[model samples]
Target: MIHDQTLDQATESSKAKKAVLYRMVMDKHTCPWGLKSKYLLERLGYEVEDHWLTTREQVDAFKARHGVTTTPQTFIGGKRIGGHSDLRTHFGLRLQDPKATSYRPVLAVFATGAGLALAASWAAFDTPFTLRAAEWFVSMTMMLLAMLKLQDVEQFSTMFLGYDLLAKRFVPYAYAYPVLEWTAGALMTAHALPWLSIPIGLAIGGIGGLSVFYAVYIQKRELKCACVGGSGAVPLGFVSLTENLFMVAMALWMLARMI
Candidate 1:
């Protein structure tokens, strides 16, 4: 049933390639779905606005504006696109959008190297209470990086297509990093095992550096960036050199401290 008022507004609204304002409740699945739609819309040459309507007043205003009472509602070109099912209907089958970037280990490596360096510097050189604070910084950085990678709606479909294949196909085996870094940085400061800390930090840096380098090689040879989070700006050969060198530097510092 078409509401006269809704139709009138749809027609009357400025014909400037209308924006889609989506209203959804704050929930685990709904939020991700909503974000995915927003990203898809952006890629499809549309501007989409997402609002979490948790209050009655907000919902009322939204209904008045868009003329839809049911939710996971999407307003595109002043027309309503329903829930997840509706969104799927819109996309049909080209879910992956082949041009979309895949997750790359190089990006993760770069982010990790920067994070570890910051954590180590703060933990090693800062005041007495700074060790624990540095640990928090490193853990939070690693966790946040992982979260951002997970939230990349652009890669949503590709990730699903070859979960098994891609899961093991990471350029530099990047998944082992967070634990290595968090543990290395924590042990270096907490237990003050200078000898152990050198090796641990070096290992963390070494793995990251090698991964980024290989990613660069793959990128140049294949003309594809496998690093995640749209961070292909970092070239791998340089990234690898920088990372390995950084690890070696950290090892030297740790060794000096032990001596």
Candidate 2:
């Protein structure tokens, strides 16, 4: 199964807690996994025979002999334990799947926004269930989402360009989007400058909702959203659409207040 090691082979040897590690220690680069492996082995109370392949020639020869494409190979009682992942598996440790779809970040962000709104309401009116609190929940969420995208604008823009209709066409709008969202959200939260915030919110929200609708709901294509940021794994259909619609609603609400 894992690294071609059977259960018996993968199991730690009972005779002696000893491991042989072959890793790179070159001038320009040292294998991080190797260091991790060495540290893990040492922490586990294993006597590690740390062998450093310093030169390219030595590294190549070692790889050729072991039939391994990468270094940081571990052997326990003459059983090959493969790379860092394989080693982790051998020890029954948890490993994060980078490609796994997760909604935790989005959920956390929204939850935080709601909590902050309730707290602000408590501070302002001595109650957490005010109409103002409801408004703040939406506006604060928008600001939080904008803040996340602003963390790495370039990555957000790249992700935005992939699905956003306006970004796909104008391109520069993708880069300016986070700033616009943050500005609109901040003004809306403060209940200031409805004229500017309303227009910006309406424009971006309308375009964003349309884009999400076209790419996700209509086409039935599952896409990762750029709403919260590129690093997060928020789905594009319902949540993304909701984000846009919230802005539209907030903008309209601001307009109604002015009227």
Candidate 3:
């Protein structure tokens, strides 16, 4: 008896989610956003009345009647639900704000870089990867970051000068920074001459650490980090500092191992 009652209640709940979706479906072109809206409505458990305006005249009439310039308009219980984005809001889904800065790009880079490192380690040395793999990961991350900077070196240098003490004093350092990072990372990854790689890594990483510390902590300046690229929106804080610290630690470890 209880099971039957629950089934009936769920059926009634689903019945209440009725919606009307009016979208363009012409001979020359079927609206892409219209399909998206229909998919979203159906996914949200909406029993949609799919009204297709197959002709241009029909589409214009529909738009004029609804006082809307766009197709793929939805209506629930006689209330207009607008387009794909509007339906998303109606269902309480979070949308990306174009005006806002996000760290997703940088985070994606780190995640991909880590996966590459782990894969490389597994391929080179079977199960239970060693500390050398971690070193490779750090070196690879630096190389990836350098590549991003090299995409627009001038822009990167400008952003770097904002928080980098060395760059601010010697503008030429900003231009040379990416090249130095690339060289150091490549040399470290290849297990090349420690005499060159270790000192370059130590100097750059140590300076970067101090610069990040002073900019974020001491001076308390709110700024974007140039670590991932000048065009990126990655915030200047813990993550940026961690990148510098990783370089410093790797360089020191390599130096000690050599000694």
Candidate 4:
């Protein structure tokens, strides 16, 4: 009926902070929202009385008693806080949208690329800051981007074909784009086969950049970028254009090395 959050019951901070959480922990399925509600209460310094509805009968009975339809209900100081979303509202926190477009994936890729570049610099040149770091940053970002695309090439290709000029005209190009990007990034990072990598980067980058500009600027079409993957929420705009431009710059920089 009641699950103690901790071994000792002495840790209730204040009457105002005290919360009661009712959740389900059935044999086959444990309610996630219940877990979240309990965690949120505990983290917010509430001494939560975690009540578990272990059986369907218990759940139904509890719901009927409370006049509520959902499990994982909370009550603060004898006042029902409703569900998890309702609890969040009580704390003035914004509820996240599952379908909202975000730049988080792009930010993560760039951050990873920067970190990898720094590590590569330290290992190779005995310093974190070096000209090679910039090169590696671009190179690593491209590889990471490509890797995400490669995970579901069909999904990425389908999304990409909507805006990518070459991919739209020649469907095969959509599938090939990720492979080409990965190959170029890998070769550039490893400092292997400049003859191949440089050209590959240039072609894909140039085409991609132009397509993004045309779709976002010229056509003014609002679309989710497939830059991360098909399921990603990155918007098609400057960030996508910048990704393409970075690849082009890296390719040119590598080409200039030979000259």
Per-prediction TM-score: 0.37, 0.69, 0.77, 0.86
- lDDT of all predictions, in order shown? 0.50, 0.89, 0.85, 0.89
Across 1-259, the per-residue lDDT of candidate 1 in tens digits comes to 2244543444344244545656556443355666666654554455566668766677678778766655667676666777655754654523434455434455565566456656666666774345444444443344343444445534422432222123346623344443444455556445466666667667656655554455445444333322233333333255335534555565666576567
What does candidate 3's lDDT look like per residue over 104-127, in tens digits? 877887877777778888888884
Candidate 4: residue 138 Cα off by (Å): 0.8
Of candidates 3 and 1, the better by TM-score: 3
Candidate 4 lDDT over residue span 131-247, tens digit each: 989999999999999999999999999899999999888999999999999999999999899999999999999999999999999999999999999989999999999999999
The residue pairs in collision within model 3 are none
The window of 10 residues in a row where model 1 has the poorest summed lDDT is 156-165
Ten-residue region with minimum lDDT total, candidate 3: 1-10
Predicted structure 3, TM vs. truth? 0.77
Candidate 3 segments exceeding 4 Å error: 1-16, 20-36, 49-72, 99-103
RMSD of 1: 11.7
Rank the models by TM-score, top first: 4, 3, 2, 1
Report the C-alpha displacement of residue 211, candidate 3, in angstroms. 1.2
